[model samples]
Target: MQTAKRLFFSLDRQTECVADYIEPDRYSFLEQLPENERYIPRGAGLSYVAASFGSKSISLGLSKFNRILAFEPSGEEPTIVVEAGISLHKLHLFLCPQGLRVPVEPGHPQISIGGCIAFNVFGKNQFREGFFESCVEEIELFHPQKGLLTCSRNENTTLFELTIGGMGLTGVIVKAKLRLKRIPSPWLNVQKIPFTDLHHMFQVMKNESQTADSLHSFNDFTSFGKGLGRGFVYAAAFSEEDTAPELLMTFKSLERKPTRRFALFNRLTIPAFNAAYRTLNTRLKPYERMPFYRFNYPIAEMSFYFDWYGRKGFVERQMLVPEAKLDPYIEKFEALLRKYRPQIVFGSCKFFSGKQCHLRFAGTGIVISMEVMPNAANQGFHDALDELNVHMGAIDNIAKDSRVTKDLIASEYPEYGKFRDLLAEYDPHRQLASALSDKLCL
Candidate 1:
């Protein structure tokens, strides 16, 4: 075990924690270190929330445990076993060469398989493919008291469900075996359609999500008046036709870019930037072909977008609201956005469909993700958003927001008590802990 004193910050840079960071390269070493200590397993450390570190806990990083342990591509459904530390980008590169890919993927390629499983992250086509839990075949978890437990649907079923999206509170994820789907090619046929208003955007999203392999939409956050929600819907599907080899290459830098000194996405520049972005993209070609990697990891090409937020960082409030309550909810949301005008810099919408699990952020609803710079106005807007979320019966993504309070979580998640009970039953002593777990009193 290589140990050091490290200071870790959330992806948003809003929270910082100091811990004894330990990197374990071997399975035995990882298993033995968790005895009678507060520790959290950390993957790529890309979580927007502080789900991996705490002031009193040991931050056990698994970066050195990354390795492809097994592969079996013979059957109708191929499967690959990989250490939890493998990054999505590395896994994609390995699978693309063999004509296979993970159906559901998070936008950031730097995220780890362990992080995806722990957070139960969804991709563009979540309305179709569901979340990362669907792709997991088996998990090897290490609990200090339980030793090493192999969890799957047919074995240790309860433990399996709890660990999938347990927010690293269940135990340390050692390795995972994932199911993969065959791909026709490593290329994609993408189409962008512009919408006139919020309702129009919703209609377009509903129509396109039915047939598109992957679907997502971008909105003009600065246009709170007449142009509210005016933007474009991006629909993509795999294409057999070949594309340029360079476009398929994986991103070179896995580390996050350093934040700039001053924020470029302030109230003044955001409106102008949003207007120019909307006009430019609306005028571009309606149809285009690009590498699948490019479509999956759009932020990789524009790493500066996050850096532009600067040292003040940003706050992203992502919530899932049912379709039945969407119109009224969005009506309230629009009013709030207007009242909080120019504070929002980025906005997006995604479709989701699945049964709601214990605290997992998946269901039949429309997910709205809005990014805003931190300030007096933005903070007030956030507090109002919190009340609005509960009043509208929305599920605020626990993994996305760092400032979510215990009261908000208890009121929002209907299955909160059940999740807490199950976690307590599994971890009677409450051996695992993180800033998030403590904040929510999990």
Candidate 2:
């Protein structure tokens, strides 16, 4: 391990930080850090905001501690115990041959399992499977002052809940026991349905959630006037048959290309891209069988997609609106998009259900996610978004960037104070801190 001065940025490339970095290969090495030294545990840094940013502490990188500690794929209840640093892609690769896989499919395959738990990530299948914490059976954390501890649903229940969506402020997660699912084949029976407006799209999504194992809508944020909110709703379920002629056993190798730093994402380019995507998808048959990897991790295929955001980068604002109030919220959202015409690089809609963890970003509602390119004249856009959140009683996803304040969290989440108390009790000295924790007063 070595200390180096460098800048760290999230996927949106919005939040940047300069700090000391260290990579500890073993749990003992992490535990040996100076007792008084402030540090923040980091996984794949998949959180698209300041959640993983450490401005005033050592950024402890856990990438080197990747290892699968235990595996039992032949039993009725298959389970895998893996080091926190292992990527979702690597984990899936190890289990695919055994006809087993993790249930929660977060968008990015590069994200670490530890980060997924910390963020309590929700995916297209959230409406059916709930958040990432739903699959977690147990977690092992190493605290600066409290030493190592193991928590599960049956024992240390409170700690298990706290660490699932704690954002790594509680401690460094070293290992996790995850429940796995068995599949007959490594392919998905995919279907793409077209919708003309946001209302129809949401209606179909709500209905499809009951039948589709995984579903998400690709929104046309660049469209306006007659074409506003026109997009496709993609849904999928595992194939029962063993035949998988189109199954890609491994992800295609991404070619290294020079970054297009000066590229501009505007109304013209975005609309054109959307039209092309829609046209190409519309010609395809209604149902097709594709590899599970392609269906679950589509973003990984476009390795250089972030280059379109340019140097200034972008910010994603994701809000969870209850199904009862979705209509009004979508009305306001459409108006905001029309008025500001922000350069939205990507956008999607997904349904969620069940009770959410203390700090997790899920509920029985619909989650609308949009990546907007920041501009000087978009203050009104921010204001409208904040107003929409309040009007719809929505909760901001901590994993995404937004204008969230301490008061908002207190008002929206009634258990915020209790969560704070737990944090204080677990780490009394407040040894684990990050820019996000300090900013939100956690």
Q: Point to the candidate with the largest lDDT.
A: 1
lDDT of 1 at 358: 90
Q: What is the TM-score of each candidate against the true structure?
A: 0.96, 0.94
List residue ranges in candidate 1 displaced over 4 A: 243-248, 252-260
As a TM-score, model 1 comes out at 0.96
Which residue segments of model 2 deviate by more than 4 Å?
Answer: 245-260
Clash counts per candidate, in order, are: 0, 0
Angstrom error of the Cα, residue 347, model 1: value is: 0.6
Give the alpha-carbon lDDT of every model: 0.85, 0.80
Top model number, TM-score:
1
RMSD of 1: 1.7
Error of 2 at 332 (Å): 2.4
